[model samples]
Target: PASTQRHVKSINKRASGQAFEVILKPLSPVSDAAHSLPSPPKRDISLDDIQKKLEAAEERRRSQEAQVLRALAEKREHERDVLMKAMEENSNFSKMAEEKLQLKMDQIKENRDAHLAAMIERLPNFHGPSTSLHPTPSFSPALTLSRADTRPWRPRGGGPHRHITPPHTIMLTTAISIISGYKHG
Candidate 1:
């Protein structure tokens, strides 16, 4: 029986335009190889990968938006805090000013009260024993004169007596009468 020989051929080409060839011999089939061979798997794709990427991007976007919103909130909160602080300070200042004014008013009232108290203390007591000051004049009905003596009294009806001498002439006549009486005495 002739020997069965397997020949391999190969070819190569060089940079100088040479050519090269290679030949491979097929191997003999093994029993049960089909069972040992692995089949080509279908290309696999998992929804988890795309979903994870989407989730990561969404998370990043959410984080960025949250940061922006947080910054805005913080700014508003800071402004509110500043406004509150200013209002509190203003209220405190006003309260202090009011207290100072009230204190001044209280001081003025106290001074006025003290002055009034001193004045009251200085006033003489009316209910105490009377001291000798001036002698009171005794009153007599005979000392009272009517218009007849001071001036010539005219009667109610426009009738007999109507003496209307000027005050100066009456005073002169009374002085002359007093001088003549003193000379005669």
Candidate 2:
């Protein structure tokens, strides 16, 4: 080929620093056997093959989607089961607590009732004599009071003659003093 003829070249180099010229050779009379060989025949693809491939791909996609959906469903079911179990446990715990509380209340009531019964049994030991509705001269002490002794008693330090300031007036006076001191200081 003309391209092969143009590429034919030879290079020579000497021990010295000088470089020889590149010499191109003439084209040889060689036959193009490699190019003359027959090429492989092109195989035709049928429409059925493409359709089968598309159906296979579609089936794979459907299978993958189904798997994902199944996994999601399983996860949801597991979560629901866990939630139900937790709720059941919580309810059971509450019921247990309520039962315990009721038991404690019953115990308290029983103890209280027992204590009341014991107190009632001991009541007669501390009971005093009950006096009759009418006063008897033999059982009562006689007293003779003059008219001057009938007046109500009064405290010695605080009487009608003593002058005392009201508590609110004292507090007000103290507050005024404190405010005046603060302003002067």
Candidate 1, superposed: residue stretches over 4 Å from native: 1-53, 126-185
- Tens-place lDDT digits, model 2, residues 133-179: 43233322112123443344444676585445444334434433433
Compared with the true structure, all predictions reach lDDT values of 0.60, 0.59
TM-score of predicted structure 2: 0.47
Alpha-carbon deviation at 143 in model 1, angstroms: 25
Worst 10 residues of 2 by lDDT: 137-146
Model 2's alpha-carbon lDDT is 0.59
Write down the lDDT that model 1 would get: 0.60
TM-score of 1: 0.37
